[model samples]
Target: MPELTGWAWALLALAAVVVGLSKTAVPGAGTIAVAIFAAVLPARQSTGVLLLLLILADLFAVAMYRRHADWKALVRLAPAVVVGVLLGVVFLWFADDVWVKRTIGVILLGVIAITLLRRRLQAGAGADTGSHRIAAATYGSLGGFTTMVANAAGPVMSMYFLAARFEVKAFLGTAAWFFAIVNVFKVPFSIGLGIITVPGLLIDLVLAPLVIVAAFFGRWLADRMPQQLFEKLVIVFTIVGAVYLLVS
Candidate 1:
C-alpha cells in the first residue's frame, strides 16, 4: 500500500463512506468522493482505486434496490455508453494528468448546465421528454466518458433519470445496476492501462467495510427522504463537486 499520511487516510475513509451513500442515497454525491480521492492520490491512480470502491458500494446498492430497475432505460443506454467508454480509453491513452483533470471538470460543469436547462424545459412543458432516443444517447455517452475518465458518472446519470421522471426507488435501482455493470466492465481497461494495481487493491481492502456500512445507512436515509429534497440535494452536491474539481 502507498505510505499515506494520517490525514490522507482519514480523507480516503470519508471518501469511501461518501461512495456508499452516493450509491444508495444521493447519486451525485459521489462526485465529492471523486474530488477527495483525486486530491489525495495521483489523478489516474485515484480513478482506478475509486473504481474498485465504487463497485463494492454498487453491490450493496444492487442488493437493496435490485427489483426497481427500468430495463428499457438500461437497454437504450448500453450501446451509447460503450462507445463513450471506448472514447475515454483513447483519451487516456495520450492525455496527461493535467488534461484528464481539466477535462473532467469541464464535463461536470457542462453536464450540470444541461441538466438544469432540461429541468426548466420539462417544468414549462409539464412533462419530461427524456425518453427520446437522442436524449438517452447523449446522456449515456457522456456518462460513459466521464465515468471512465474520472469515475464521475454519478451526476450525469442522476440528471438523466431525473429528467426521465423516475421515482426515487426506480432511479436508485436503475443507477445501481447501471453502474454495477459499467464499473465491472471498466476493470479490465483500467488494469490494462496499469491504473488498477496491487497497492490500490490493498487500500480498498481496508476501506471496503466502511463502504458496506455506509450503504445501509444511505438506504435507511433514502427511504425517509422526500422526493423534492432528494432532487435538490443531488443538484446541490453536483454543483459543489463541479466547482471543487475546477478550482482544486
Candidate 2:
C-alpha cells in the first residue's frame, strides 16, 4: 500500500481534524491538511489525496449545515473559480513536486499576513469595495487556483466571508456547501491527473472515517460558540497556520 509511516499516519489524523474544524468552526485553518500531506506524500500526490479528504470533510460539513449556506454568494463565485481552476491546471503542467511544496507554503504565508492586516484594518477602519461581483470574481479565482494546486481553497473564500461580516453559522454553512461542491468536482480532475492511485485510495479508506467523526465534533463546538468568539478564534488560528507553513 502507498501508506504513510506510523508518524505520518498520526500527522494525517491530526490534519483530518483540522479539515473538520475548518469547515465547522474556523473556515480557514486547513493549511494543516496541506502541511501533513506534503510532509508525508510526494508534493503532487498530496494535493490529490488531500482533495479527496477535503471532499469527504466537505460532505460532512454540508450535511451538518446545508441550511446555513448563502446560495447567492456561491453562485456569484463559481464562474471566476472555474477560470482559476483552468489556470491552476496549466501551472501544474510546469511545476514539479518540490516547487508545489514551496508554492503552497509561500501562498499560505501571504494569506496569513493578509488576513491579519484585514483584521487590524477592520478594527480601526475597513476597506472600501465597489461590488459583490468584484469580490466574488477575485476570491473565486484565488480559491480555484489554490485548491487546484495545493488544496488551499479554505483561506481564500474565508477572507471574503469574513469581510462580508457573516455571522458565524452562516460563514461556516456557506463554506461547508461551497467546499463540498468544489471538492466533489475535483475528483475527475485528480483522477485524470493520476494523483489518486490504488495505494493512495487504500490509505484514504483508513483515514476517511476519522474525517466524519471530527466533523461531528466540530459541528457541536461551532453550534455552541457565540459568533464573535468563533470568528476571533478563526483569525487567531489562521495566523498560527500561516506561521506553521512559513517555518515548515
Q: Top lDDT: which candidate number?
A: 1
Compose the digit string of candidate 2's lDDT tens values, residues 1-248: 76457898898888878877777777777877777888888876777777877888888888888998999989989998898888888888898766655665676567656655666766766555555777788778878887888887776777778867789878988888888878877778878888877777777788888888888889888878987787777666656655665576
Off by over 4 Å in 1: 124-131
Screening candidate 2 with a backbone cut-off below 3 angstroms (N, C-alpha, C), the clashing residue pairs are none
Error of 1 at 87 (Å): 0.3
lDDT tens digits by residue: candidate 1, 1-248: 79999999999999999999999999999999998998999887888899999999999999999999999999999999999999999999999877776787788788778878877776856554444687789999989998898898888888889878788999999999999999999999999999998989999999999999999999999999999999899888878877777777
- Per model, state how many residue pairs clash: 0, 0
Candidate 2, overall lDDT? 0.78
Compute the lDDT for candidate 1. 0.90
Q: List the residue pairs that clash in candidate 1.
A: none
